[model samples]
Target: MRNIFIFIIFISMLFVSLSACQKEDEKLKGLVIESSSVEFGSLQNPEDRELHFRVQINDYGMESEQEYKVRFIIQDAHISDLIATEKIEVPETYKTQLLRNDEARTIVTGGSKEIKKDFTIDEIRKIIEKDEAVIIELYDKNRTIDREVVTTFAENIKPLVKVNPNAKLEHIKLKETNEIDIFSRAISDSNKEQGISYIAYPEYTFSLAEESYFLWVTENNGRIMNTKDTYTIYSLSDSSLKEVKEVIDKK
Candidate 1:
């Protein structure tokens, strides 16, 4: 009789342990992300820009509500922008853990996620282009257990233009002689069939001596239309081409 009682007690304990283990296993089941992309327009200057994203864990079974921490990381230096780090909580009901005696205490399984952002053409023209890596992370409360995620964003590689060695032209036309048009497409190629190709306009005021004009033109885009050092002089008194040498001589 004593032996039988001991055997019965052991069987009951085993059943209880197995039940607890099953409950905990059930809590680690589901995962989700609320939103994948967040946009940051025109950060700092017109050049700096960024994007944000979030990942959420969900549908975990729990006796009471609990919370989990989340984080972000940038893995590839060339692809992503590391703007800032963020943390969020996952509710207990959305997370699960097994009983003390259960072999499966907590089970969380998911794949790496991704988020992306890009620069506009105008923004690319204003800044130097380079590749960068971005990463995101999701962490537990103590920050001990963290899941790192990574993705890449391509940098803009368009050419830009700036004015250098400013020269004064006499009687410039506001409509036809606009500096914006002149500098922007100053490095464009003139083709009879296509007219002009891959030309970008400048975006600054023409100044004297101290100011330098700079422009970016690439063969891939097109060739510069005009290579003359002097400006065309247009006047009602004499509508003729005068060498810039003549103007500089007068100065």
Candidate 2:
């Protein structure tokens, strides 16, 4: 009789442990961030940041009654230490099953309700060290992982020349030196018909040292915003110009 009682007690504890784990399995499976096309080559301010990016999370284990938050983290990839944490409150609507192309999916994908909470260049630079990591995840008070994804953002920011659509040409500046070598593309006869001559700055008034070729652009040439460019820039270091970056006005 005594042995039977002990066996039953052990069996009861095992059942409770298994039940706890099964309940824990009710959380999401994984999270992913939509890719950003933010090319801040010479990005100057946080105002130019891509503030409204989306994050997709698996809702397989969301709690219907409780609220959750997505946390953006930047850390050292190798050291695995937190450098910064930015949290965005998840909407109450996402606390349920995710639906998709006429079928039930398990993902909660959307943007932040508060635009200011979006990550920006200032926040990204905090973790710009070599081999750093950026992580985004969802978590309720008691729920955790599959809730998260680890990744990084843009790096290697360099100064590049730009040609505006309205025929305004601008030079990207280095922290120390504003001078760069400029080269002109051979304008074919076909392109000349489009009034491909470089136009002066329409808004700002500035003095040019002389006929600076690298600083000119074919105004109103229908150039792609980010894919087409008219100048090859070279760094003006120590009285000599060395080709550094080829600037493109990509669409």
Best by TM-score: 2
TM-score of each: 0.30, 0.33
Tens-digit per-residue lDDT, 23-76, candidate 2? 666322322222321122223442232333245554444444435665544344
lDDT of each: 0.33, 0.36
lDDT of 2 at 139: 64
Cα lDDT of model 1 by residue, 166-232, tens digit: 6432322223333434333332223222222134443222222232332222322322212121111
C-alpha root-mean-square deviation, candidate 2: 13.4
* Candidate 1 wrong stretches, greater than 4 Å: 1-49, 59-68, 80-136, 145-251
The 10-residue segment with the lowest total lDDT in model 1: 231-240
Model 1's C-alpha root-mean-square deviation from the true structure amounts to 14.8
For model 2, what is the error of residue 79's alpha carbon versus the real structure, in angstroms, after optimal superposition?
A: 17
